[model samples]
Target: MSNRLLAIVEVSPEARIACQANGCGHAVYKRIHVVSINGSLQVLGSECFKRLFGGAIGGNPAYSSSDGRRLTDAERRMLQENTAQLVAQLEAEHEAAQDPAREKLQRISQSGIAREASGGPPHRFRAPLPVRQPAAPRRHLGPTPEAIRKYEAQAKIDVRAKFDVDPNLPGWRGLVLQRITELSKSDEVPD
Candidate 1:
């Protein structure tokens, strides 16, 4: 005798019916109606329906308490109230998050700087102006060309003095002076 859920009906509080599941005979205001394969109708309570159908009516799972038990009428009402409170709190938080950006856009629209490129009236839909900072001062590294020339000229004088003090020094001393003279005349900067 296979049976399937037909419908869940809500009856008057004064007309409660008894559950028909195996050993449970509790009276209830809401009753589940099921029809057997042989066309027999049966009435069951919420808890009895959960036991017989594994907490589903027509392939849809029924809401139950955290302990897997079906909720009472009082518990269902409390759940709905808590859900409404949470939704209101989330909406308030989202509005608070958007306030700063909205304020900045409003300020830009009020200011005269956000005018249209075509010399028309200022647009209320323009983007906020970019904040620009002043450029930093640049620093110069290494010696200047004039400083290099002055140092090379002084070096030539020092080398000439060394050669005069000892005439037997290596001939590389003259080549060094000649290279210094060539460097001072050229425009290329040393690495």
Candidate 2:
């Protein structure tokens, strides 16, 4: 069985679920559920889960509560608030990191040095070029409708004369008519 971590969930201490990891049958509040290729579930505690999976789950190794008990509502709220604060701090740092490049671009644009070096007018004085529409695609140079009709009519007459069968008739007569039509189509002028 190819065992893999599926989910981590909080369970009530009263449920009394025991870790399935070898040599570790501790009672668990935070249960790590593992599913095998054959669709069997095995539950393990955080410590045992880490040992078995070699810390593949990532994130902080510690459980939500210090003693591995289910967290209180207040503790959950505090954790969320702390997480939000950390995210805001990271975003601020990212903005600060980009400040130098932003400042350089701003300076270049304001000084008009970039425009002068590129031999283009300053931003305010420049006018946009007229958009040239693309030319329509050329079509295949084929026989005109009148020429195609004339060829088909002549072919039908020739087939009827050679095969001694009405081109409109079914069976072998229909095949002759089809061959005549294909020959007429092939007479179209090439591009």
Number of the top-ranking candidate, with TM-score as the measure: 2
What tens digits encode model 1's per-residue C-alpha lDDT throughout 1-191?
A: 55455434444565555666678877776543432324454556677666776644463212211222333454333323453333334346557878999999888766645466557677555688898988987874544777676646555555667555432257655655564665556633343
lDDT of 1: 0.52
TM accuracy, model 1: 0.28
Please provide TM-scores, in order, for all candidate models, with all chains considered together: 0.28, 0.32
Compute the lDDT of residue 152 as modeled in candidate 1: 63
Per-candidate alpha-carbon RMSD to the true structure: 20.4, 15.9
- Model 2 misses residue 191 by how many Å? 23
Q: At residue 189, what lDDT does model 2 achieve? A: 25
